[model samples]
Target: MFALMQSTRTQSLHLTVDAATGLKAVIAIHSDRVGPALGGCRYLAYPDDESAMIDAIRLAQGMSYKAALAGLPLGGGKAVIIRNPHVENRAALFEAFGRFIESLEGRYITAIDSGTSTVDMDCIALSTQHVTSTTAAGDPSPHTAMGVFAGIRATSMARLGSDNLEGLRVAVQGLGNVGYALAEQLHAAGAELLVSDYDSGRVQLAMEQFGAHPVASEALISTPCDIFAPCGLGSILNCQSVNQLRCAAVAGSANNQLTNLQAADQLEARGILYAPDYIINSGGLIYVALKHRGEDLGTITAHLARIPLRLTEVFAHAQAEKRSPARVAESLAERLVYQKGV
Candidate 1:
């Protein structure tokens, strides 16, 4: 564990267990150089404690890169609450988790992520002030979708020589809050949509509402399209999956899309313009960070407008260096967060 921390340059790792509430959580603080660690809390079942710790560590590191690349005055951390399927009281469980957060004081501020909701945030707020995405704070999904939409346009401009989405085919691989919202925007822009999800209801809804063609989840990666948006889980793009892709570009709101750094090189070799996940999917973090600092909606929107410009810069640098955008983004983020070139 210490070796992992040293390798990733993570600052610290914390854990807490409340037997009564069945709360078992791990928090990984990747860095606090720029500011306090800010990230989301994920509540999902894991195979083991080691898996949970690794997830938290990788996600915490991504959050740090996300914040640094977005030019936010915040560091990165992440929390994973190993789900207790048999727990009777959900609120009590989250509240106990909140107390664990409070114990860290202000070092970590958590919001909503996968398997978590605003209600959970409210419950967490009951014990600690270091929480966001409460009902009052509003959902960050739309903002995240908005940023991704802009990023897709920017990516289109870089790869296709045009920012227009009309008449283009886009395969979206998730139907969660962010993915569904992005599909709505893409439909509004007259983009042809091919959508897949584990939930039949969400896929049916997309078909009925957005005229999206339904594709099997397993086959979506191989589906030919102008853009492949992975708005779901991480590590979707691995060695075999990369070879299966038939898209011109990859962009979405997923965190850590590449299974490893070498995956970026593979995408580049295959002539796929890869939008680094952390850089393109930072809309929610921006919304949460600015809102926490009391910024208005106008201010937040203005900040979001920078996503495309930053991505354009990354693309230009990648083109100049003859490297993948993922590598360029990682190098740039490391320089900012670590205060030295990697």
Candidate 2:
């Protein structure tokens, strides 16, 4: 665990267990160079404690990069609550988790992430003010999807010589809030949609709503399309999966999409344009950060408009350097978070 932190340059890890509420959580602070670390809190079951710790550390690092490249005056951190199926009271567990967040003072701010919701953030807020995405702060999923939609247009313009999605085949993997919303936008743009998800209901809904053709989850990566959008979990693009992709470009709202840095090289080797996940999917972070600062909806929307510009900059740099956009984005984010190149 210490080795992992050292390799990632993570600043600290905090662990707390509340036997009464059956709360076991890990908060990893990756960096605070620019300002207080801010990220979403994820609550999910894990195979083991080590897995949970690793998730927190990796996610926190991604948040740091996400905030830095988005030009936000903040650093990165993340909290993961190991789900307890036997726990009787969810609110009590989250409230206890909130108190734990409060104990950190102002070093970390929490928001909604996968397996967590605005209601959970509201509960956390009851205990600590260091929470966003509450019932009042609003859900960040739509903004995240909006940003990703713009990014896909920019990516298409970069790789296909046009941003028009009309008649383009787009394979959308995952039917979560963000993925579904993105599909809606793509469908509105007249893109022919190929959809897949573990949930049969979401797939059926997509088919009915967007005239989407359903693809098996296992085969979606290999399905030919103009663009592949992965709005699900992380580590989807690894050695084996990257070899199976049949798309011209990959873009979506999933963080840490590449299992390892080498996957980016593999995509470039295959002529698949890759939009760094953290850079393309940063709309949620931008929304929550600005909203937390009391910015209105108009200001937040304007900030989201910059997602494509940043992605275009990364693409240009990658082309000039003859490297993958993932590598270039990491270098750029590192310079900002660590102040390495000013």
Candidate 3:
């Protein structure tokens, strides 16, 4: 299984910096099923070279599934810029990234991801027209959250037999862009919210903007809520944290939620409804795919509305066959891609 998983890490196009600073940039294009691969370029200070490579490879692989499940005519690709943006040569780094994208010549389209933002994407757009900057309309976080909000409703209906979130208590871990947007939707639905973040400022914003109940970072998972939303980072829903969760369902935007397939099975045995990350957090991919193809927002919104239906199907399959939701989601995505000969 490890070998198969690692096989997903295709060789990336690498470019090394020639500055006094040693920086590495990688563009990993996982697949091109529906169309050309599309993903965000992230700039961060990885602890080591291997870590950055693994993140780029894994994220790109996830994008392939994300676009496939979202029914988009695009594949998956990701770019990673080595060096902590806070301390790096911003102009040189971004220019190098832009030149790198230019080198691809439309094979791989770059956008914003975890560490990359609209402002940063603007820098990328300067040197390469291949960069996508839908950020002008505003952050995609709220739209993503809206999609997740819709998904929760769909999941609740299919799994918990609830159609409304009027009285639902949701614990959102990581009050970032998508997290804050999700909080807004929950508040609008009259759902009580508990939010947490590594940044105190974001936590305070969640509290001030939505009147959220803030919790310590360590307590976010076991807050005894209807939904445990891990919006911050990946691998939080592993074996240890799964045992600590007090929520009825696990759903959020973070990628690679399960550390491994065994943890996904563990969540199933515990009867905790697990919405696969690749399936539920597909809104961003959908938006980018549309922008890449020059499609309008109405078309994008219509496509986004199908997420809940997809979730319903995945949940039913999991329950009926006694399989993990992640596996079911992956199987369905692979079947679609395989049928298309992609």
Query: In model 2, where is the ten-residue run with the lowest total lDDT?
Result: 333-342
Question: What is the Cα-based lDDT of residue 174 in candidate 3?
Answer: 84
C-alpha-based local distance difference test score of model 1: 0.94
Candidate 3 whole-model C-alpha lDDT, 0 to 1 = 0.80
lDDT tens per residue, model 3, 213-295: 99999988887988888888788977898999887788888888888888998888888888988888888777766766678
Alpha-carbon deviation at 117 in model 1, angstroms: 0.5
Model 3 scores worst on lDDT over the 10 consecutive residues at 9-18
**Steric clash pairs (candidate 1):** none
Whole-model lDDT values for every prediction: 0.94, 0.93, 0.80
Candidate 2 — what's its lDDT? 0.93
Error of 2 at 204 (Å): 1.1
Ranking by lDDT: 1, 2, 3
- Model 3 residue runs over 4 Å out of place are 1-6, 9-15, 18-23, 85-88, 134-138
Could you arrange the candidates by TM-score from highest to lowest?
Answer: 1, 2, 3
- For model 1, residues 1-342, the per-residue Cα lDDT tens digits are 888888888899999999899899999999876588999999999999999999999999999999988989898999999997899999999999999999987999999999999999999999999998999998899999999999999999999999999999999999999999999999999999999999999999999999999999999999999999999999999989999999999999999899998989999999999999998889999999999899999999999999999999999999999999999999999888888321
